[model samples]
Target: MKTADIQPFFATLKAANPSPQTELEYTSVFELLAAVLLSAQATDVGVNKATRKLFPVANTPQAILALGLESLEGYIKTIGLFRSKAKHLMETCRILVERHDGQVPDTREALEALPGVGRKTANVVLNVAFGQPTMAVDTHIFRVSNRTGLAPGKNPLEVEKQLMRRVPGDYAVDSHHWLILLGRYVCQARKPRCWECLVSSYCDYSPKTPPPQGSLR
Candidate 1:
């Protein structure tokens, strides 16, 4: 998309949600890191449901360390890969206390060095918790970027680079959330609601999906 088209794309998103935030629920950076780690291949709603119960008892690295792996597994066993997630979470907690003074690190290298944290998860932590302007290109973003011609790429790394270069400066910080939310709700995987999309006029997609039949709206 052209730079001109990009302006209005973000303007609409900013106008609608002046201060958007991650749907993941967490009080501290430690909790945020833990929540994001568990969110791999799982929904934010599911992660939040589990974290809500877990965080109340142990929101910090030290606190979670005290919870022990068995107890931690009990809280998050409902999520996928609970056994592995529990192992990683406990190891990450140990690393945090031993290396980063029980706080989540700010840099990508330091953050990714933690057990089970990947590029996408690190990007989320840096962007949301540390106010870094990084985009974590997940499935939703990859699909939207390709479909809308916003930041087309063959892989996540390529898409991340494309977004970094294409997204306007004013919107780069919030683009992650906006694009993810848009793709999750509007530009869905099965049937994209292109006709009702706010930026449909600017999108370069072919054979756009029309509005649903017999809609009240």
Candidate 2:
């Protein structure tokens, strides 16, 4: 996709939902950070289900630290890597309390310095929590970036850089969520639903799938 095409594409997305929010439910920055950390290799549905219970009891870094890793595991065991995630969560909380005064850090470097928080997680925190225009390339975004000729790259970091360079400023803030949801629901890995995709016309995927014959939604 050309630089010119990017603006209208995001305009359509924003028009559909003016204030698109992260599917992972959280009431505070700390909760959002912890939920995103646990979301690796997990689904939003599962993360939300777990956090709905966890957040009520411990919504801050210091509070979660006091919850202890064993108790934390009980709540998030349904998620994959619960043991490691629990440990990371506790350690991150400790770092937050000791270094950042129990608040979720706003800077990428500071956020990344916390356990379980990397570039992807930090990008999400900055964008969703702080309303910055950073884009975090997850599997879905990576696939969409390449499949749509929007920002093709072999690695997530490279793709992220391309997207940052190419995406229009007006849409950059919410493009992360738009691209992720588009790939998760429409541009699926097994069988992309190209037939009903809103951005199918702009996509560069070859031999796009057509809607079933005589079928209407």
Candidate 3:
């Protein structure tokens, strides 16, 4: 999309949902970090299902450390790569407790230093928990950025930089959530629901998908 269309594109998203939030269920910053960690190859629904059981039992770094690796694995065993994720969570908690006094650090450097926390995960925590304007370019954000011509790039890091530079300051902090939701629900990968997309008018994609037979446009 043209730079001129960027404003209204995000404006429409903001009007539709003024306050967007991550689908991952979390009551605390640490919970958010943990949920994002466990969500690498898993869906928010799956992560939430496991975290629902795990958080009540152990929500903090110290509390999670108390659960032991085996128990932690048991709690999240339903998720794919549970063993590795559990191991990473265990190590991350150890670092949080030993290095940061059991508190989730807000800095990108500190967050990325933890086990299992990559740039994407760090960006998510920094944006959602700390209200930073960092873009966590997940598959959803990456696809939406390219598909909508909002910030097309060959890779996630490239896309993230593009978004950081392109997105308006007023919508920067929450733009990640908007693009993610748009991709997840409307500008889908397999087949975009362009017929119902609210911002399709500003999108650059061609031959927008039509509504199914008997479906309302």
Among the numbered candidates, top TM-score falls to 3
Q: Per-residue error at 95 for model 3, in Å?
A: 0.5
lDDT of model 3, residue 48: 96
lDDT of 3 by residue, 1-217 (tens): 8999999999999999999999999999999999999999789999999999999999999999899999999999999999999999999999999999899999999999999999999999999999999999999999999988999999999999999999999999999999989998999999999999999999999999999999966
Model 2 lDDT per residue over 1-217, tens place: 7766788778877888788788999888988999999999999999999999999898888888889989999999999999999999999999989988888889999999988888999999999999999989999999999998999999999999999999988888989999998888889998789987888777788899877789794
TM-score (all chains, Cα) for each model? 0.97, 0.96, 0.99
Candidate 3's C-alpha runs over 4 A off are none
Q: Local error of candidate 3 at 116, Å?
A: 0.2
For candidate 3, the lDDT comes to 0.95
lDDT: which candidate is best? 3
Q: Worst ten-residue run, lDDT, model 3?
A: 208-217
Candidate 1 residues 1-217, lDDT tens each?
A: 6668888988998898888899999888888999999999999999999998999998988998999999999999999999999999999999999998898899999998999999999999999998889999999999988888889999999999999999888888889999999999999999889877888888888688877788754
lDDT values for all models: 0.91, 0.90, 0.95
Task: After the best TM-score superposition of candidate 1, give how far the Cα of residue 185 lies from its true spot, in angstroms.
Answer: 0.5
Provide the global lDDT of candidate 2 against the true structure: 0.90
